[model samples]
Target chain A: MLVHHLYSGGKDSSLAAWILTRLGYEVKLVTVSFGLLDNWRFARETAERLGFEHQVLYLPREVLEKAAEIAIEDGRPNNAIQFIHEKALEALASLPEVGRVSDGTRRDDRVPLLDLSKARSLEDRFGVAYIRPLLGLGYKTIRELTERLFIVEIRESEELEKADYEVELRHIMREKGLDPLEIFPKRHYQSRVLGWREKGI
Target chain B: MLVHHLYSGGKDSSLAAWILTRLGYEVKLVTVSFGLLDNWRFARETAERLGFEHQVLYLPREVLEKAAEIAIEDGRPNNAIQFIHEKALEALASLPEVGRVSDGTRRDDRVPLLDLSKARSLEDRFGVAYIRPLLGLGYKTIRELTERLFIVEIRESEELEKADYEVELRHIMREKGLDPLEIFPKRHYQSRVLGWREKGI
Candidate 1:
């Protein structure tokens, strides 16, 4: 069985991929780019370090434009990221080779979250299985698992070089002269995976 | 890391244990009994077949009594089962050797479901992590996975011998001369795990 995991070179998605691999599924780490920036290369690099097959799929530039508009109008990023996340998942699920799709969305995630109804609808529409291994793990548990399983670098959200939609969305926000820092919450930390932790370390 | 998974000898929980085991956690399959019946032995049999360590934990009989009262008063089993599920999780988390807990609850399950707030509260109070591997999987995906991994026996709910709290709770309902059929939905199916599937089968 093959599982496509949305990759952002981040702790949560990396751990999710590791779990699927352990569970006897071949995992393909995929990063979606909006064609606005080359940050998707970060995820590709992490995938290379993790020794998994990696690919970057492109979504239309307008998708990020609409998401940025939503963020600027709402003065927040939750709905905007969630919107792009759905589109990305749809694009992944529509692929002929993709039968199972997963993401790093956790039980405590506010943005890029997929509720049960939407999840079921996605599965029904795409004929794909949506798996979220971290859905039941809370914030503290995820931190513990990531620390035990991976080498990660944590920094402020803006300082982190990652492949998530926020990077591209923020780029558009800047083009509109709206500072993303004003919209996104302060003190947010983002983690980028460096490599796997050795056993007995 | 050790995770104590609430075992019912059913497909959902058995699959959860399999996932935790594959993820490098030492899983102890624990079946909680209200001391009403010996059905927990069914779980012990499956655990033995899977070659995992298993135990039977006894809860207070009064807990079932209260749950039965709630079921009879409300004419439904969702709230009653949820109440007992919370108590069972608390008991599991309270074990000194236990640092993490998990269950078979799925995304679409109405009864015995733990919402985010309660799950977090359980973790905070017990200083343990709660993991639900099946939390994001819907009915179709669960059925597909169980079929691929386990040889299961499917039958009417009442015909299935299981270790879940419902078995004992229904016993209490019968003692009250209440037909559990009235409280539980008709035409429900339950599955018991026979064993694991071969690698190529």
Candidate 2:
């Protein structure tokens, strides 16, 4: 009955957690932290505002180290971020108490997308249900739903600095003497959940 | 916002309607019928048990007639059913009061599946959000969720006689002097939601 949502402190994952709760699943928001930055704490704050239990899942630096290598070699962040997303999902699915693991990857998502075969492989191997509440939805529809159900703050992805693989991946890239902005795209807007709309939409 | 869910009186659509309601959408369960049979009335009873507003959206017989031609010509029901599913979604999206249209199409569904391009096209042309709540979930996961949430009756597709495109498609096939059993897979099982589990899972 309990589902662990891969929380990024952003509107998408926050909305996913809310949806699970509404579907009668006890949702625990978990942020995977590689210890590159303190962004997970920001996710914790957002989770608190949403009134859900939040926890930080710490992975060894090596998991992200490999992803960084991929990013540097490929001269792009998409594949590296995707690798991290899979690792995060695998880690969540491996938890003893986690029967269902979810994320906010939508239909339009590219960098951190999990394909169906990979998702099914995780489920079959780990004996956990991989639930993606936003997978059926597109970018515009997600924006509409979030606008209806949440009070969100939108800013440039770098300025927002929410808890996600990109934050830590960018840090690793910078540590390796590569400018993240050059490697990753600019003008990317990230949304962080402020709280629910006081008066229902 | 109000969402018109294409209801089949089956567990998938029923669960989709429940999910939409939980996500704070005013859900109207609509059964798209070609009037080949009275199966839509059966869906109405199930919708009543679930306490949602139910309506029957009647399509012109010619639509199913086209689909029937495809099925009989192809010697299979998959493409034919898929054709009907698209038409049903389009009809729901075109309704004056409907700003959001959804279906019970899941990740593993084959016959009635709508690809992302088609879904987006519907959204663009109809000015409605094409929402598929179960799109991220596979058949096994759906079975688990339904077990937790509703009391479902499982039987052969022919015996169940649900208000889905398949039911009407089969009727048309029989009327055209083709045996549906020879066309559709014989071992296929259909589930109908009787009511919610009293004590919960």
Candidate 3:
């Protein structure tokens, strides 16, 4: 079996991919770029270290910005993040060999969650199974697994600017004279995987 | 500093007690019994294994039943559980050596949660600090820590009839011809810690 995994190079996504590999599936890591200021090099490096086949798909900046505008208009980032997430799933599901798509979404994830309605729609429209192997796992479990699997370097989301598309969207919103706090709450802890030491390296 | 810890002999409470001990507090494990079908022998055994000073406080069945009735009337178990939990805190706060009270409530716990208002009142009225070290730690972390610290046996909430006070309360309500299901939702996961392997055993 082959699974197309949405890779963000973060602990959750990496763990999700690792789980797929453990489940006897060949995982093709798919990273969606929203044409932000991101180079997505960290994700590429993680895929290399983990020794997986990887691909990067690009989405138009206008599409992402439009989604962000809708979220900002509604005074929330949830809708915007969900929109981008749905788009990424759609893109991954479009792959020819991808009969199944997976992500590292845990039970506790809020913003990037794919609602049941969207998931049902994807399964119906694309005939692709959506899987979240880490759905019931918690932050501590993910961190524990990551620590054991890879020698990882963690950086705050702000420090790893390109890791999250929201950073670019927030920057764009700021340029438009809109306060980012109005759309997104503060003190949310998000981290990016900078690089990793191979096991025993 | 001596802390009174509300214990239930479950993984969460045991882990909470373990955390408090590590943090250098003199932990007095306090288990509240609602005069139900429980002697709380499991809690006593756990306290003994963990080497903590243990106390079992009794709350009148009428008091607990009344709270359940109110919650049934309100169509929610959250309020009823919180009421019982607050009463437990109030009782523990009255102890002279107890400058602080803590619980094993985790981030994902719904019922028996201390709302902001109740927490504030506890602090303002009793001048006792209410702490939940497991507040932000999720289910996985608690279980992992429990597994690491002690050899544990887990039993389902239904299987361990006397472990949770809610079971007896539900029985009482059932006797009153009120369907407990209407008040308390089904498939709630609660557990009893049967025994733990000694450090060297």
Candidate 4:
């Protein structure tokens, strides 16, 4: 089956893509750009190295802003991220070639989580299957698998300059002369994927 | 330090003992018996195989009955199991050589858990440090480590013929002509460690 995987070039996403490839699925790596300071350069590099068809979907600034506004109003990033993720899935589902959508959402992930209600709605509305390959696996399992399968470089999310919804939301807050810290608290132990070496068996 | 580890001859306890040994601690394995139909044969066998000093402490039947009564009263096994666990810790703390007591409690374990208040009281009153080596590690991590470190035999709790508080509680219900099934529901995946082969590095 043709599976459009939401790739962020992170360890979890990379591992999920690797699993799909191993499972004999025709996987297409899709990374969404929210018009942040960073781009999908590393994601493209990862896709090339892993040898999968890659695509970059640019999300409009207004959509991202609307999600950010909701997040700010709710005083939590989780709601905002989930909103953005649903929108991204909707965009992917609109494509005729994409019969299924998948992401790297693991058992431990709280944000960007497709709740059961939302998942059911998407499947019923678009007649598309939503799959999360790593949903059963926890954080430690994912990290261990990533270490064994690929030579990965781990860095702080900020240092990696990876394009994500949070970066754009922070930028919007800054542009409006509002304290980003008030809207979004600093997260600890947020590791971002910089690059990878040889794919270990 | 001489640490008395509560050994059940199960995967979690065995893994906990393995981790403690790796950490260079003088470990003593203790298996508590509540005088059920099942015996401590496998626990003794595991201790012999692992080359640790093994001690089997007999828990009074009345104590187990009291805990079981409480569980029946509350209609929950968690509180009852926790009570039994605390009593076991108390018994271990009374030992002259045992400066600290440890257990196989992992991050995923809900029943038989030492809550913060109980843990604090144990430490303050008895001056015994309670250590749970596998407390930070989840089921996936523990299972992965068990697979890598030792050759394990997995089976249901009933099939193992191992003496545990649960068995004794059920026995008490059976003696009173009460349906044990009503009190303790059948658990699907209860793996007991029959034995291990060569210990991996």
lDDT of 2 at A59: 85
Candidate 4 lDDT, A85-116, residue by residue in tens: 88998888778887778888765577887655
i-RMSD values for every candidate model:
1.4, 1.3, 11.6, 12.2
Question: How would you class the docking of model 4?
Answer: incorrect
Q: Candidate 2 - CAPRI tier?
A: medium
Off by over 4 Å in 3: A1-201, B74-76, B156-161, B174-190, B195-201
State the DockQ of every prediction.
0.71, 0.67, 0.03, 0.04
- Global local distance difference test of model 4: 0.71
- Share of real contacts kept by model 2? 0.64
For all candidates in order, the CA lDDT equals: 0.86, 0.83, 0.70, 0.71
The residue-by-residue lDDT of candidate 3 on B110-199, one tens digit each, is: 778775567657766887777675654444445545665676654455634444556666767777888888887787455555555444
Best-first order by lDDT: 1, 2, 4, 3
Per-residue CA lDDT of model 3 for A33-141, tens digit only, reads 8665565666787788778888887877886788778877889888887788888888778878777888877655776876556666776688776766665334444
Best by TM-score: 1
Write model 2 residue lDDT over B1-201, tens digit each, in one string: 888888988888888888887777788889988876888988999988888889999998999999988888888988888888888888888988888898888887766887778878999999988888998886666887788889988776664367778778888888888898888777667677899885331
Best of the two (1, 3) by lDDT:
1
TM-score: the better of candidates 1 and 3: 1
Local accuracy of candidate 1 as per-residue lDDT tens digits, B103-143: 98989888788878888899999999899988977776677
Candidate 1, residues A49-111, lDDT tens digits: the string is: 888899998999999999988888899998999999999999999999999999988998887
Q: How do the candidates score on chain B by TM-score?
A: 0.93, 0.93, 0.84, 0.90
Off by over 4 Å in 1: A155-160, A187-189, A199-201, B156-160, B199-201
